[model samples]
Target chain A: MSLQVSKNGDVVVIEVDGQLIVGNRQELKQRVLDEAEGGARKILIDFARAGYIDSSGLGVLVSLAKRMRELGGDLRLANLNDDLQTLFELTKLDSLFQIADTRERALESF
Target chain B: MHAALDIRVPSDVQQIEAIVAQVVRRCREHRFDGRQLSLNVPVALTEALSNAILRGNGDAAGKCVRVRAEVTEMRLVLEVEDEGAGFDLEACTEDPTTPENLEREDGRGLFLMRSLMDRVERFRGDGNVVRLTLNRR
Candidate 1:
């Protein structure tokens, strides 16, 4: 998946394009970690363009959430479609991370 | 009756897209619902295929994952076979929802597979076969 990084105030928003699967989970993980390393405390993943994510992709998101929490910051997700929302609910990861419905709301959350 | 689909791919991670696409397209033709086509089919198939490739086959260069599907108006049945020793359904229990396992990197694929598919069963014949079924709504 191709990722585009932008800033809304201090919150860094990364827009993901395409399906997030095992083949591309690592690229997403490294990008988030890089943002954390660059002193971006609050990060948001905008899934406006992303269609769906596989289990591997969900695992990577879980790991990133844990890592960001340990670093005294957090990573949030926004603009997830209905299917993605159901995936997170089924896996019980919805409680582990803060999910917003829009980029503005996610930015406000951070 | 719709013709069954039979295909095979080497243990490559990149081929997962093509396989999922094929399964979804075929299921769609058989009147699978929107939720099944978008979420259940792709997520379950990806998990099953990736597990067959990476875990079951160990990503061996020569190993292949065989996929066979029988799609009817009532349901979609898919069997994914991997060139592995065997699979023990009873012994494969890892709860990713638990607090301890939540942060772990692995073990969610099986859960997702079971959760998405209507029925998931394992068999050992020529290879380890994972049968996934989704009933049409």
Candidate 2:
């Protein structure tokens, strides 16, 4: 799995490509945390290219949301596939995250 | 059509990605439905293998985890065996969906596997073996 971080004004859009499972979720987490620590207040994760995510990946996203909120910032998710969206709903993580339908909306939500 | 996949590797977290890839490829080749391919197998296999590597094998360098998958006309069966003693599902106290346990990082693997797969069975005799089944009809 790979993570690409780009910026839309003050919002950092992290595009995760490939499967986010136990093996690679930590890298994504570290990158997200680095962006949060580096003073990026509004973080948007674009999962348009990500096909799969396991419990570990879900955990990372949850932790990331909590971390960002603790820093007085917010983390949003964008462009999640149907399966992932279902996963979030099943796990109730959808309630915890501000998931947008598009990157534009995600950025505007901030 | 019928096929089988087998791999035995040392207990390491890094092996999960390759294993998940192989499972995905085989499932696709077997012509699983969208929900089975996009949701069930990925989540179930990753959870089962991660459990085998991290929990069942205790991440021991010398220990090995064996994964075998078979696809036939009836069902898709996956077996993951690790070198540890075993685990008691009844002993697990944490519920991932619980209000207090939702944010905990470590306890959702088993829950995800059970939720995604059609059947999740644990066999304990010589070692720990988790068998996951997904019906294909």
- Scored by TM-score, the top model is 1
Could you tell me every candidate's TM-score relative to the true structure? Answer: 0.95, 0.94
Query: Given candidate 1, what's the lDDT at residue A98?
Result: 93
Off by over 4 Å in 2: B1-3
Per-residue lDDT of B49-120 in model 1, one digit per residue for the tens? Answer: 998998899988988999998898988888999998867877888888988787777788889988988899
lDDT of 1 at B112: 90
What are the lDDT scores of the predictions, listed in order? 0.89, 0.85
Please compute DockQ, using alpha carbons, for every candidate against the native two-chain complex. Answer: 0.77, 0.73
lDDT of 2 by residue, A1-110 (tens): 88888999999999999988888888988998888778888899999999889999999988888888889999899999999998888787787788999999888888
Residue-by-residue lDDT tens digits, candidate 1, A5-108 = 99988888999998999988999999999989999889899999997799889989988988989999989999999999999898888878899999888888
Residue B35's lDDT in candidate 2: 87
